[model samples]
Target: MIDTADEFESACRILAAASGPVAVDVERASGFRYSARAYLVQVSRRDAGVFLFDPPAIGDMQALQRAIGDEEWVFHAASQDLPSLRELDLVPPRIFDTELSARLLGWPKVGLGAVVERTLGIVLKKEHSAADWSTRPMPQSWLEYAALDVEHLLDVRDLIADELAETGKLEWALEEFADELVRLPKPAPAEPWRKLNGLNKIRGRRNLAIARAFWLSRDALARELDAAPGRLVPDRSLVAAVVAQPRSKGELSSLKEFTGRQSRTQIDRWWQAFVDGRATEDLPAERVPSDALPPVRAWSGRRPEADERIKAAKPAVEAHAEFLSIPTENLLTPDHLRRVAWQPPEPLTEDAIGEALASHGARPWQIAQTAPIIRSAFVHAAQASDDTDESAS
Candidate 1:
């Protein structure tokens, strides 16, 4: 385990002198910690071999980044690790995501272990996936598991790249990889309390407000303790306490989930949260945001023409995706499809539809393939509307 500045410097020299793209992987203590910091970073190169460095210990990766200058960094699921990597001032200039490539090539299973076994006849162990990587004096066994993650990643990348090239989808994969580089982790959701599981079961705005209070309280406590929000106060227990609306700290502590030592200790805090919730003015309503689209399920009554447009447009997308043997989602996001279909361009022609898709961030390849199909669907729908009107007249 390289921890000191000297060791990291040595590792950098080894990496800088190595040939070919570097393979990278990171282990994060997701369920065990509040922050998404990388506990361990593992890197491999064909000549430099595998090196596991403790990011928290060395506290400097600038030297490491310099070592890896313009070489492509290969990762299994690049998005999952990229954000944590960015925290250490490490960002890949060029990246090749094997998982994204597999999805583009229409692989049925894209998990690292599954893809490795299918492509290279090797099985990866999976026991330590849930282990707390933030523990001090990292165990040797866990270190070995982390090392194995990047050991064969370069080989796997080579094989997958060849297959992508054979099918003339290499450029497509590159485009997706480039897009992934700019893809930041999704923003913290708005009204995060509304996302609590089984919150819908709580009746009335008052009780909903109570649930929100509990959620905010729990989130603050979790952040203070550097613990996962769920670990601090399970969602189910929070919802139960709010729904029951226990009048006092003692009454709230009587619940089974709250009887645990951890929960019992925080009874006053929980009770205060409930009281504050009821006393607060201007509670949030469950209405959609002004700029947001309504749920697709309600579109039939809310916007019947949009519903008709989407229904007409979907088959075209599915047919094209099937012909190309890629996931329909990779071809074009369903949300983007819905957006274009709902408000199709004026004088709907192939060029106009293409412009709409491009505006919504569709790649050129995607627009080139999907625009013609969507235009045909729109034109056909318009003709059907004209025929219906003529018959009524």
Candidate 2:
């Protein structure tokens, strides 16, 4: 492991002299740690063999960045690793995502191990994939597993790229990878506590407020202790506490879910959470305001005409996707379909529908195939509306 700045510079010198695209992978402590920082980063090249760096110990990587500035980085899932890599100022100018390429080629199983096994006839062992990388004195077997991740990435990329070229989908794959590079991280949810697994089972706004308060306290404690929020207190216990609404420390201590050693030690802390929750002035809203269109399945009861429009538009999209041999979602997203059907653009001509699709992030190919179908559906709905008005008169 290249831990110190001096060791990192030596590794950078070696990598800078190598001649080929870089294969990159990272190991993170997802459930075991509070942060999403990369614990270990592995990079391999045709000439460089393989190199591993401990990111936490090597504080600055400007030299390493300079070495890889102009090379194309290959990753099994580029988007998943890019964010953590970016945290260390390691951004690639060009990238190829094998996972995205496999999806474009319509491969059913696109996992790293699956793709390598099928394409290169190499079956990778995945035993330590979920092990805690935050532990010191890293095991030799785990390090070997990490190294193997990037060993055949270059060969995998070549074989997949060749297949994409033969099938005339190379441009499509490039477009998808470019989009992933520029894609922004999703914003944190407004009420993260409400997303707990069993929160929906809790009744009443009052109980929800109590559960939310408990979740917030647990989250703060987790951060302080550098542990996962779920590890500090499970969602099931939060929901149970809300249901029981225990008024005293004694009552809260008697709950089965709170019988763990940690929970027992933190009995007063848990009791205070309940106390503050019951006394909070602003209880959480039962339902947050939403700007999104309602579910398509609910359109029948909410608006029959909108339902008619969606039913008319779907078959055309399905036919086009089948003809082109692509997934229905890749052809046109359901959210885009629903938005257009709910409130179509004015004039509802082929041109207007085309612009609408573009604003909704549809590619040129998708817009060309889906615009006409959506226009026809809206036009038919308009004619039906006109006839209904005339008959009422």
TM-score of each: 0.95, 0.91
Tell me the alpha-carbon RMSD of every candidate.
1.8, 2.6
Tens digit of lDDT per residue, candidate 1, span 240-342?
A: 8877778788889888755332577888888889998888885768553655677888888998778778888898899899999999999998878898878
Runs off by more than 4 Å, candidate 2:
259-261, 376-393
Clashing pairs in 2: none
Model 1 steric clash pairs: none
Task: Give, for candidate 2, the lowest lDDT window spanning 10 residues.
Answer: 257-266
Off by over 4 Å in 1: 257-261, 288-290
Global lDDT of each candidate:
0.88, 0.85
* Candidate number with greatest lDDT: 1
lDDT of each residue in 1-393, candidate 2, tens digit only: 778888899899999999889999999988877788899999998888888889888888788889987999999999989999999999999899998888777787889999999899999998988988877778989899999999999999999999999988788778777777887897899998988879888877778878888888888888887777777677888788888878789988888876443577787788888988888888878889878898889998998888878888888778877776667887788788888888788887888888888787776766877898788867787688779889999
Q: How does candidate 2 fare on TM-score?
A: 0.91
**Candidate 1 weakest lDDT stretch, 10 residues:** 255-264
